[model samples]
Target: MSVVDAWRPETAAGGFTRDDEDVAFYTRINALIHSDMVVVDLGAGRGSRYDEGSAPFRKSFFNLQGRVKQLIGVDVDPAVLEHPYLDEALVTEPGARLPLADQSVDMIISEWVLEHVEHPQEFGAEVQRVLKPGGWFCAITPNKWGYVGIANRIIPEKVKNALMRRVWPDRPDMDVFPTYYRLNTLARTRRMFGDGAWEHCSYSANGTPKYHGNRSFGFALVGLFQTFVPSLMRTNLFVFIRRTA
Candidate 1:
């Protein structure tokens, strides 16, 4: 058995555990989805999850291609044009206005995208502009106060990029972007998406440890520690906000 299999037996048969973070994050978004709603995927890449070999079951939950009326993906990377789960794709410049019209979308979802947002005000403004009055904006990002975020902030860029390449060999170099962490913490996220214009809830969550160096012992140790870490110290933040205006 592989180290991950030995460490997480529940994921031995497939890449899912009791409280899988992907499952949890997607579940919330899926519940908000309806057949006729127009949806936008912010910072959507070229469907890298498929390239990374996500399990079929997990992929089913992540794919929103046919479930919604329109699935538009917007990202800075041109690779987004080839995104498998989007009906349409747009490549935009940083801080540029989205091509979408005001109040045109019913929902917007962002996964692993907020950390790279250097200007949260511009980001939030764009999101608010495109979404309908009752539209939902949901995202899952690494928590700025978490261990991974702290390490990322302290580590040298070259060293961190080198280490990430070694740890996630399957991930493409282009897919890795520099993180600013300006909108990562709960406080900042709340401020960006709050102010009576939106009804929002943000919380922390823990996922499987990925930096165990392929060692079963290390994986198990970190997994145990992850379970006991305080809420604010959890690795990920899930933000769900609905426009109330």
Candidate 2:
């Protein structure tokens, strides 16, 4: 089930469109790349999020474009373990202890993964544990209070839970992603890192389309409104943290 043996590049597989903000968001993250760094891509998806000829979960393969020395991808999904660029792939339950040695990783990157994790605190601790002292941990997750988040929240909790069930009925106990954003804001996200162990470098609210080629002015306005009214932008949050010993 290792990626090296299983991966097969497909030309028919489409890539992410430039219209989505994720293109810019990922590019910005790519700028931080250094050729010598050992990067771990957590929850690295199928690589369709970036481009063809690329693996989904390991953004460095598409984003850094070979600037990275080594890339490791970790996800619970067996399909993701088959990405071509993954130097190694480990399958583990989301938010459980990662199967990596202490202080072994120089940088860790995850996109849109926090919402899927059942216990973010444990996940954060795992990130801290695997990172070398002064290593970087970067992630993007939906802001629970943003426009999309508000729309989700205004629904009855029972309905929300039902929707989660309908989408991922296979894992009844798994929190169907984006669960914590409503309660975990920028301030709260900073707090979760605890004491001086971590520092938040940035926080921003942006639009994330559920569908391709479907950008709307109304949705853009909502994102803009959330900037001034932090209470409104509950849909997405991006953060960069440096782990300190």
Candidate 3:
């Protein structure tokens, strides 16, 4: 068996095997989904989960098509137009306003997208403006204070692309983008959204050192070491907030 298959379960909670960051992220958003809600997928690309060749069981949680009234996809990349799950796909420019009317969407979900946001204030303004009153915006992103974020910020984009190609060959080069950690940290993000307009909650999560070249024994060893890292500097941040204004 591959390293992920053999070692992931050992690191998972209660050795369930299937539990991981993706499961946690999708589960949190899935619970918030309702049949009548219009959901916007911010920075949605061409249905990347499907491209990753995940099993049906794994992909099931990531799929968010018919469960909502409408699943609108907005992305700076035109590849979003090909998103299989989107009811409507609109192309947008970086730092440009979203095409939807103000308060039109009931929920917005961004996965691995915030790290690429160069203009956070403009992005936050669009998120707040597009969501209906009391709308929810949930996102999963790399924590700027974490090892991954630190390395990402320090490394050149070309080097990152090459390293990612070596470590995760399955992921396409087109999916990679330059990262700016301006909105990645807990303090900065909280400040950007502010307290009066949004009710927020955020937490950090850590998983196996998958970037360590797919070796099972090495992965297990590093995974154990990862447990001792402070919670605040964990690999990823899951943010959930409701628009209060």
Candidate 4:
């Protein structure tokens, strides 16, 4: 079944989700926001840039407009300052410290972002510093062993950038960053986040292939891939953790 259809039932709590992971995630975020808590979205590119490839997931997030007391967007690319889903935007250097105060945020949402960080462990530290006690950080990232991630690690940056620009011409106009598979795998992610040893953590492999385009054959091919390949080889991974101290 398509991811969106899979998550249809749990839209009950608040917001929406295209997959099981996001259902649990948005449910938690919805509850926190009902309490007037603050949430930050990392790598929150403009909603306009959310292509057909990820539109369903993006729509679920967009559905959160008035539900949250406050939703903040932070990105290395200044163009994301225009994210419609965010109350405000903070643009900073790609691995620079977050502008938020320590322990000030109730939740962190990161979508298709962790793989691009130059220093994944440092990003973990920042997440630890900004999140309040019991605050959860939820992320969707590509698995390094997946076909897409292997291509990213193997391809030269300039060539890949050029290819992406050629294929998805709008990236240059919106926001595009390099991918470094540094924290893509479950083990690496766990070890890095272990730096803070946030009181609780969970990781789940999202059994979807990332190489698909908007075509049915593309979708079917990936569906076939997932059916035959091991779960670990699938493209998406979920990283959920909470700061309890």
Candidate 5:
């Protein structure tokens, strides 16, 4: 569920696009974080984040010890115990409540996780519950209105899982979950965060046809989606939020 961060254009022969604006957006958020911050990584896998992939919690600059007070990883799979980037890990039920105390987390980050949430409304409330007043939230998830998204919405889950297994066998099935895409659009984000009184720091659409290895149909569809469609139709959505007092 990772995309290339390189700034490749949608109109290029490679049929891929990159929205580096997300990197810049994250840079701003990174500057706001301090060494004493208590960060929670929602749905963080076994630290599979990489260069082409987003960094662990999408914060490469703060990866070292003492860079941040803590980075807690929460996942549905116990394999999260293998997460190297985490100071602590918590395994939870799929779509169940978070285990953290109320108003405890200073920051919350989700990398490609918002899409798979079974119930985003309740989940958003949970996020607000765990985050302290004035706390920050940032995330990267696929745009459900994008090219790959349209295809995914139409394709059956079983078919999609089969495709994923064939396309990305190295990635475990536990890493993949049913995508809801409830928070995929700009309007949807506004309704979710704005209604909760969360301050909107920034938001953007990022990435391109990196899915399916830039194959023919996906490449063509995503290229067109990146070019002709609006930003909401891009491959990924980058959102930054701040909880209000």
Candidate 6:
């Protein structure tokens, strides 16, 4: 089954609510938006979750009616390409060679996807190959050093794999897909881009401590920690990189 067919939007799994936190977070990374740029959103999950009413996932696309030259949304799951804002959509395997032409795209954005990709180095290389000189790439993934990573390490591999299957039983076929942060560290990310291929702007996100049913106190506390020791927080990792010619 396709990834989309496996994971249906569970409103109970924290519905898509863009509060002050989301606005500020997205704004920082999307500040490089331009009208003439060919923007590509990778791993663009079911666009419905965020495109409610008219609010675009990237705040910069909010007022870009005629301004946007083209917007392409690509994902392994074909069901996620039904966004009104998308000029085109492509279904492709994750971590494999993207179907886009080399250096054809001006900007790329990905959210919560890198962690699930088994070969992130290849993925990063593909992003570098597809982006034009000076193009920007923004991505978000879970951090491996944060509290969640700690928890994952403590759990046995067998148990963790079982839990993942339970949480996403719909896609039992993809149960082998690596979950959680894998190749996501400041040093590792820099290396993936090669020597002087790109520059990092900022990397920050909230973390998760304990996952006790729906209680989010631990998650909230980790967010507070991000305010201070930003590097230590574990929930997510947001990165902005500009391609260098």
- Candidate 2: stretches off by over 4 Å: 1-20, 50-61, 154-183, 208-234
lDDT-superior candidate, 2 or 5: 5
Residue 171 displacement (Å), model 5: 4.6
Write candidate 1's Cα lDDT for 25-117 as tens digits: 998888889999999999998888865568887888889989999999999999999887789999999989998999999999999999999
- The TM-score that candidate 3 achieves is 0.92
Q: Write the per-residue lDDT of candidate 2 for residues 1-245, one digit (tens) a residue.
A: 22211221221244333234465556666777788888998887655444554445435435553777888888887756666667777888755788888998888888777665667677777888899988888877767666556656577878867764553344435324445442246776687786788867857656533311123543345445645674445456777888887
Error of 5 at 73 (Å): 1.0
Tell me the lDDT of candidate 2: 0.64
- After superposing candidate 1 on the true structure, give the runs of residues whose Cα lies further than 4 Å from its correct spot: 12-14
Each prediction's whole-model lDDT (CA): 0.87, 0.64, 0.83, 0.70, 0.72, 0.64
In model 3, the worst 10-residue window by lDDT is: 10-19
**Residue pairs with backbone overlap in model 1:** none
Per TM-score, the best of the predicted structures is: 1
**Candidate 1 vs 5: which has more lDDT:** 1
Q: Which candidate is the best by lDDT?
A: 1
lDDT of 5 by residue, 113-201 (tens): 88888788888888989999989888877778876677678888789778766555567555666777777776787788786668885
Pairs that collide, model 3: none
Off by over 4 Å in 4: 1-33, 49-61, 157-173, 207-210, 213-216
Sorted by TM-score, highest first, which candidate order results? 1, 3, 5, 4, 6, 2
Candidate 6 per-residue lDDT over residues 24-113, each given as its tens digit? 445764577767888887876556434444333343433333555787888888775665557888889866789899999998887667
Better of 3 and 4 by lDDT: 3
In model 6, which regions exceed 4 Å deviation?
A: 1-21, 51-67, 153-177, 207-212, 216-230
